[model samples]
Target chain A: MTIDARADRVTLAAVAAEARVSISTVSKVLNGRADVSEATRERVEGLLGRHGYRRRTSPSSAAPLIELVFHELDTIWAMELIRGVEDVAREASASVVLTESGTRHAPGPEWLEGVLQRRPLGVVLVFSSLPAGVKDQLRSRAIPFAVVDPAGDPDPDVPSVGSANWSGGLAATRHLLELGHRRIAMITGPEDMMCSLARLDGYRSAMSNAGHGVDPTLVRFGDFHVQGGHDIATELLALPADRRPTAIFAGSDLQALGVLEAARRQGLRVPEDLSVVGYDDVAVARWSSPALTTVHQPLRNMAQEAARLVLRAREGASVSTRMDLATSLVVRNSTARLVEPTEA
Target chain B: MTIDARADRVTLAAVAAEARVSISTVSKVLNGRADVSEATRERVEGLLGRHGYRRRTSPSSAAPLIELVFHELDTIWAMELIRGVEDVAREASASVVLTESGTRHAPGPEWLEGVLQRRPLGVVLVFSSLPAGVKDQLRSRAIPFAVVDPAGDPDPDVPSVGSANWSGGLAATRHLLELGHRRIAMITGPEDMMCSLARLDGYRSAMSNAGHGVDPTLVRFGDFHVQGGHDIATELLALPADRRPTAIFAGSDLQALGVLEAARRQGLRVPEDLSVVGYDDVAVARWSSPALTTVHQPLRNMAQEAARLVLRAREGASVSTRMDLATSLVVRNSTARLVEPTEA
Candidate 1:
């Protein structure tokens, strides 16, 4: 894509003239640095109105370079995903920009159009569920892009690269089963997300394959956040002691941490009293109190693949769009063999 | 900026035709996507070579609309920093494009030039330490940008925002001192970095104010990483018992984790035998075993302020420069009072 040379159409002189203030004051107000008086800031803002010196809107050759878009940044899951995207973009000889969709706090479309108009060689969507219309728009514009851990049913046509969530779920559950856990409960991410659904399905299939019926009551839905895990675990704890499951499986590491906290608050010791397992062995998992047992997604590999996908799409590849990588379970101290409950 | 109305530019189709491949495959190669057999990909490369279709390097009316430029995204510090920048940019009514200077891995003028040429309205330097000459180049362009936690004594003229590191360090050290620990040691960040220096200054000043001579041997330098903390702590543990400080202060949360691991490997009980305090109380701090007693920098707040600075700078605010926000200490179980040798 060509750069828009005249992007910086709005000049400081224009803003200063419109604002009726010294250029320095206006600049200070803009920068929010100390030294600008309140009255001057307001006056400058008014002048900005009269002069119509809006920040550059349309992508010009002068506009900033490509941006890396994230659905949410607070979650630990996004950390590795982001690092992966950055690593690949760095190697590809491209500059990286960052933005978040805020699916967790609120859902809306703001950055998508701006990103589309920029005509970046490609974009990386981190663990985001792109709206159907937005996806169609990208397709029509032929904007090369890729999504990591897309949260929905797999669409055979869209190019995506991520780990096998379903298989990861199965691996997590199977590990518990192998250690003699018969009654296993699960905490899953939001229903709309593909990874969450796949993981839940994995849990179910593993139980079924082991000749056991999945208990609907034992499964709880969470928002894939720490608080969600805490809330779900608290709900699980409210059940009578006799009905409590022998093991708990969390969909994400943050959720597993919440589970640990919930168990701790209830005076239950990890592994000794309650066996817990988590997904996404983030850096925190290794140092947590019990050193969580988890399933590790090939984060770096997925990021590299996603970057490659977007770059390829930008280069023009009319091919099937989907990638499902594998996951491996790590045996940590969080899980132990099932022990028969002593009769009170 | 007004949208350039220029139409008839050479499209991907033209390049594909020149390369003698489907338009899709050419798109893939240019965008850097994978899937075409190596032979076809190489052939496409040769075709682009034979036919001088230089991929639209010149500036034109229709500039790429958005860009995402980052200082570096390879480090965990940079990754979180980008997340916040990305989140705010999406909400600020503009699309983003991603770019990086890769300053840590490759610090050169050529790298800086590529980013500036993109001409984004604003750029977010993710925990950047821009070389002196590069800053001048950016200033000459009058490009509006923001830096996060700049490395050394930040220039007062540039508009950047970050948590108050001096206060953060002071708070961390104060907490350890208040816990009745007299002999405290420190593991600091990169020596040249302003934040590291400020933190060290805070640590020293705190001890001096409390009638303690700053022991030079008790202090160590690390690169603000996990292994750095681990290595330093291991070395500290090898010292004679009387020489080893009873309490330790680590510069960053990542490094603190390494220190924790070292303590564990040495069979040192947290609080009972030793105390630790860390800075930049990242999210992981809360869940870490013994829960890191550290200082918290409002990362989200710092990010939001930086975005505001850039937006204001874009609005013709000539008065732009550095910003220093405040920080607080978060007390946890990682630290305890100092006990006499015979007390136990």
Candidate 2:
């Protein structure tokens, strides 16, 4: 990661001259200082980007740091992602700076300033896409960035890492089908997310491939949390004995836990009375009373890939713009073979 | 927050003169630059500590950063602590820098260098104690530090936050006793950990207070994880039916899940055939099949207090040297009144 290797790199002075601004003004704009006017900042940034101007690094200024930004860090999946970044950072002898900027972060002018000042080697964002303004800011400073998108959505212009959500849903549903379950219910994430739609389509495809028609009544949208699973399962379980599904496939592990709770409330035995399958084989999936038969999303590996991508890009290495890792089903004790109704 | 406000602060130049070194050498030592010799560095640091030298902060050098060092981040309790620090950092417009230096940090010589370079506002250590060398390094630079120790044992010299582990254990056992459970079993953490010993003592006290003798054969120590709970419970449940316990108290929520699985495998229904109580009411407690009756150890709050203490100390405010948060019992569906054996 030396500066002079790229013989074609543009000079800061050239960018300043092209923008018709002083070197100091260009520097201020590069550092994300608010002193420069918005128009002037944008023009300087455009010139810097077009010229492919990479900032010169001083021994003192090149801090061993990797910045990680998330929409929210309270989710169960966040820990796995953090551990992944930490793994890479540790090997590189770098420390990770963590920030939780909500989705409403407008191009992250507020958060972007901190990154610019810190001048981290690279950034790993836990979002589906980076805003245009934010992308420009990072590019101008030569601070490479990549997104770790769990939603299976990515911006065409941004480098991103995601899991095979469609495949995960397909495998989860197929496990129940193999268990001889005909009445299987599916609870997916919010309908608006691309990952949710992809997963739902996979579930439909699995049912279709099994020589069975999709039961519209057995499909429901969930919020991907425990409460969503609980609420959806509560009503689904309350249906008539003949109509109630003997198996349920949940969108996430948290949701699967909710389904289990609902089953326990009604005196139903897991794997015996009601089989349940979960997505995202997180810690709780295995720790749940009846370990969930679920799909592994490879969250940690995805995060590691994103961080590695950003670091390599920062070091002037060409890398993949998009990488989708595989997901697979893990059969635990939560699912069982379907049995006939003994009461009848 | 300002340099002039602290009239009693020692000067760097004075320390340099007293240590027979140039001001530049002191500067290098403060920056953690490796150019300085170890002998000179130690002498200069000793003089700085003795004289109480406080580094003058320039506006640009004051990074809005908080350093959090953990022995390991893989523990289940880490996420909550991270969130607590993030809460304070967000409110104060500071970002958290995380490092996972194992317990063998050796006063964090490798980690301390990075922290000194970052010049964060303050630091929160998750370990029970900081090595003398590490403590001296932070102090010479006037970097305030605090510990958020879950292990109960904490260094008296360090400002720390711990929970009422003894109370948690007592409450859990008492809950079982109140439910008419006489043949109760207890699973504490590793014997070497202060928390484990404290909790064990609490259980002993609770049983004695209720005029009941604790059955020696019914007690066991666990690793505070799911596997530990399961392995221990399996053997306990396998004891002769006449000597088998009617209730069990687990060391942690993860352990409680293991116990639940053990009960299921043995065809024993919880809260009916066997009541269970868990310590540390983490997320899994509520999500468990039969929601766990647990002791809530305010982990998040303890983290917040530790972070707050560090920040306040950094700003020259006097703060508590130690803070022990309270623990309370949460009655859920896992515990019930003991009923006579149906076989009898």
Error of model 2, residue B188, in angstroms: 0.9
Q: What is the C-alpha RMSD of each candidate to the true structure, in Å?
A: 14.0, 3.2
DockQ of each: 0.23, 0.78
Per-model lDDT:
0.68, 0.87
| After superposition, candidate 2 runs with Cα above 4 Å error | A1-22, A34-61, A104-107, A341-344, B1-21, B38-40, B50-61, B104-107, B341-344
lDDT of 2 by residue, B46-78 (tens): 887787666655434558899988888888899
| Local accuracy of candidate 1 as per-residue lDDT tens digits, B185-244 | 899998777789889988988988888887788898889877788889888877898787
Q: Residue pairs in steric clash, candidate 2?
A: none
Model 1, A89-204: lDDT tens digits are 66756555556656642224445545544556667776445566555444534456677654545445567777788899999999999988877899988877778888999999
- TM-score of each model's B chain? 0.72, 0.93
Chain A TM-scores, all candidates?
0.72, 0.91
- Over A100-171, each residue of candidate 2 has an lDDT whose tens digit, in order, gives 986633335667888898899889999887768788778767788999999887998899999999998889
Query: Backbone collision count in every prediction?
Result: 71, 0
